[model samples]
Target chain A: MPDTVATGPGPAPSGTALRELTFGEAIREALAEEMRRDPRVVLLGEDVAEAGTPFKVVKGLVEEFGKDRVVDTPISEAGFTGLAVGAAMTGLRPIVDIMFGDFLALIMDQVVNQAAKIHYMSGGKWKVPMVIRATMGATRRSAAQHSQSLHAWPSHVPGLKVAIPSTPYDAKGLLKAAIRDDNPIVFFEDKISYAKVKGPVPDEDYVIPLGVADIKREGRDITLVATSSMVQVALGAAAMLEEIGINAEVVDPRTTWPLDEKTLIESVRKTSRCIVVDEGYYRYGITGEIASVIAEGAFYDLDGPVRRIGARHVPVPFSPPLEDATVPTERDLFTMARQMCNK
Target chain B: MATAPNPATTGVEAGTPLRMYRQMIAIRLFEERVNDLYTRALMPGLAHLYIGEEAVAVGICEALRADDYITSTHRGHGHCLAKGAAPHLMFAELLGKEAGYCKGKGGSMHIADPATGNLGANAIVGGGAALATGAAYASKVLGQGRVAVCFFGEGALGQGVLYESMNLAQLWKLPVIYACENNLYNEYTHYSETTAGDPVARPAAFGLPAETVDGQDVRAVHAAASRMVERARRGDGPGFLLLNTYRFRGHHVGDIAREYYRPKHEEQHWMAERDPVALHAAWLVSEGLADQAMLDRIEKEVAAEMDAAVEFAQNAPYPDPQRVDEDVYA
Candidate 1:
């Protein structure tokens, strides 16, 4: 492979100001650009203003936007989540951060019942244009409550559009589009990838529309579908599989709902074998969804059964070794992909 | 909009005792008609009658400007009628017809009319507090000088969001008033079984001014609400009113099995002596604001209006099934 062979998807950063940014910095830039674009856009969550949040994804936002716009809320998930929906209804583009993904259950009534159903239940009389950001993934040993990923919950909901960006470039582009989208959306940020993932993001403003998937690596032997932080795992597994003469195509369904089924089906069709990977637990999780959708829509193209690799069905443990055992590793994915290729 | 200079301060349009009496008559008759329709199966679903708590909505609403906002609870017909929602459209919503305020998609517990500043009646307990706070925030940011009134029950105190919204409301001094209609019971359980701490002092813990009023006495409730609404409009922070009242009817139309809950003597005590509608009517007569004939005429007119509303709801068409899923997203 050469630099002349075009290593990345889409056009090269179309501005002279292209630079590498950490995932958190890319998200902050996205929020700043959108807030500058629309005055109604405001950020509200616990510790958003004074502390820049626990992950510092929204660091320095309070200085750019005043304290009024960049708000710090009390630790009331259900309360403020409902308040965000209320603010969205009246005339505010509220971007609420849940701090940790597991705490979304505290606001499940407001999020799933109210925010997701308000537009439909009101017969189009109201639109809840808001974004809820939650930090997900299980590597930092935040323990069971903080580290677990819950993308599967939002994906099952009807009205909400879910997005899990795997890279800084996608994080910036997809977040801007989500902020502008009129529907209520749940945007999941991989805590494990926030600082570890970096890519060339353009300084110029742009948006990556929701419900579209990005091809991170092109291959022909077997199709690998991944999500969030697991996208990196799939790419790593692809490199490992290539040593045995297996070429694995990697597809990131950036947005969970309104999936780019066409790209996935085409990739699966070309490869005639498929494997899905997700940070969520294997049972009743996103991996099951992708595997089933491919089997249903592109069954004729499959050479064998479509497989999946995901976290085991158990609470994420406190100890390092037990937690490590709970999550699927790159080598685990390698075994599944190699089994798919019979290599 | 401040009607607090006097206990009987006249509202901008419908503030006099006579007009307020007429409004109360309309609400009482409207709820009776809705109860009748639900019994006959002409309308579907449970209608939380605004039977015993008329003064809470009427008195509080009389102090509001037309542009001011209100977030209502499940037992919200009185609030809607007091806020100027057309009874015909309200009946239409109950009947699941296209002519409803929410075009029949939102039924009794979820009726909302943004055009009239009725943010919507929430099915979930304490759900509307957050929305009302946000509406008040919008009023402040828009510089509209408008105020928001949130109508919740004593049961809402058990909800965590109530305290959350109150803290935020006082912290920013948003132009909003929290009106709690402590109707003695939450569905079947006594409110004492669910609530904790003193009701009036609850909001005060958040440093917001809160008071308890006689919800049966329209004049007292009106005076207290007027004072609160006036303070909110001046950006003086939010106020809370704990209005003690009782419901004469069952919680819903089908909830007639009351033996397991409060004693029959309690219902008789409220209905026999402290009926809000009857109390207000007696006051109107004692004050020489209306005679027996005048009160009789108002009831007849309201009854006729109720008949028309029922007829209109019956004649209105159901919404097309194709439109059911149209609004799930943008």
Candidate 2:
């Protein structure tokens, strides 16, 4: 826990500089450490072993862990997800890799009805300790099918825990915590941030528990609550706002299900204005839920109605300019924050 | 793919057939009690009786060890009972009492008991297939030598996940068995109207050793199931068993007006000519395994046991409202 502060997002306040790792390397380190720690943990997905996924995040894992531990499954989402649920119930801790977050629709029944409810349905006799690692975010010209952030789907389910890590530091720690948790967790990684994002990670093991919020920056004028890829945009917008005299604080609620409402409400109460940014759709998505929580918890302390910014309702287009327009950008957050701050 | 083996070569002990006969009777009587509870409005929800298909569950379950796993279907009372579930608690669950296997959280359709390896009865048509296959995968990975049996009706053949699971099971050489109880009809409609091509060839295409047996014959079912179960225990991969049988009763207890889909003569013919319990009883008597008086004694004993179980369930208290949300998370 002591090293967590040193390796967390942003620069180290003190002590020696830690080695920097890309978002992909941090995730791979977390998986390798967990697998070495416990024999029960097994990884399975399409091309996960040899091909290392299209992102190359898990590229040398099969060689280190062997094909048995890092299994490459056929493209049967429902089948393997259900299999992971059963394997979790019986003994082994399974990590199911759903290549894209958009394919969650194909495995909803297995994840929601079976994996999520197995413990309650069995009257506490069984527990599913499994993690579903999926990729979210768009903008690589993959079009509508492969490019939607569907984290809101699992967030609405009762028994599932949803984790969305933004920084390489949080990615490693939070993924480690998710792997060791005793519940079914859906961990969504921002595909666009895999290689582009870099941050300090310790050589030792650490876990950032789910449901805790991290304040990326401190300010007094306004508070911006962001998640996953939006954290970087919110930080950029905050930096832009500081130049214009209005200071903005950025808070990331890393996990949506076990949401850190206390930190969000307290920050909003301190600043007296709030804006929620997420990569999912603007309508009936995670932004609305978090915004409502802050509105109810810090209603009396607010200076204005809590605003929400998220992905546009339109499907992510294949064209670069059109695709870029659908997602929230730094300028969108800056414009919204300036309007809220009356600057 | 091979045909069903000779029942005599099934390696069943001399007393096993008599025990199988008694188990079949117990299932028949248990279903009768369930029907009585439904008719009197004592039970809360739908009850799918395994009255005619008793041979399938008892036969397959008898071939399994207490530690081996079995995934059951919606009409799962017979499977649960054969797999060693306490009848009193099973009845209590049907009546929504606190003493049930799932503490009344899961009703007749979802009776799960970890002690006997009854993974749980899934209400969705083919929902438990992947769960069984997954358990087999775990067994293989952990070197546990445990085998899993998935029991489903012919209606499950329409579910795509079943095929997906089968493909994975065969591809991985998982130690699981697909026990398809083809009771002629899918709910009210015949399977021939819904299922295209030969059912046997389906698993054969996946390179599984597919076999079919008369589900009404307990010895025949036990014979084929034992071979498959042993093969799986030896890590020889998955097998498929198509159980050709009939559903003598309606789909559910409330489906009494089945004359719209099936005629009375067909029902009577199955009841009289192909009753599994009656056939097994007659075979037992003819084989000198037991006489008329002994069969009468067994029936009387099972009837009394069911009567007491129903009474216990009727008298048991319902689960407390405060504990409704207790098991939502671990």
Clashes of each: 1, 0
Write model 2 residue lDDT over A120-176, tens digit each, in one string. Answer: 877778889999999999888999989999999999988899999999989999999
Model 1 stretches with alpha carbons more than 4 Å out: A1-17, B1-12
Q: Candidate 2 residues B1-330, lDDT tens each?
A: 111221321232322887787778888999999999998998998999999999999899888887788899899999988887778889998888898888898899999988888889998899899999999999999999989999999999999889989999999999999999998889999899999999989999899998899999999999999999999989899999999888989999999898888899999999999999999999988999889988888788778888888999989989999999888767
lDDT of each: 0.85, 0.89
- Highest TM-score among the candidates is held by which one? 2
Quote the positional error of residue A126 for candidate 1 in Å.
2.1
DockQ of each: 0.59, 0.69
In candidate 2, position B60 carries an lDDT of: 90
TM-score of every candidate relative to the true structure: 0.94, 0.95
Q: Model 1 over residues B1-330: C-alpha lDDT tens digits?
A: 422122121332368777677677778999998899889887788888988889899899889987788888889999988887888989999899989888888899888876678888888899888888877887776678889899998888888888889988888889989999999888899988887778888887899998899998888998999999999999998999999999888889888879799889999999999987888889888988778887887787777778888899899999998888777788
How would you encode candidate 1's per-residue C-alpha lDDT over A268-307 as one tens digit per residue? 9999999999999899999888998899888999999999
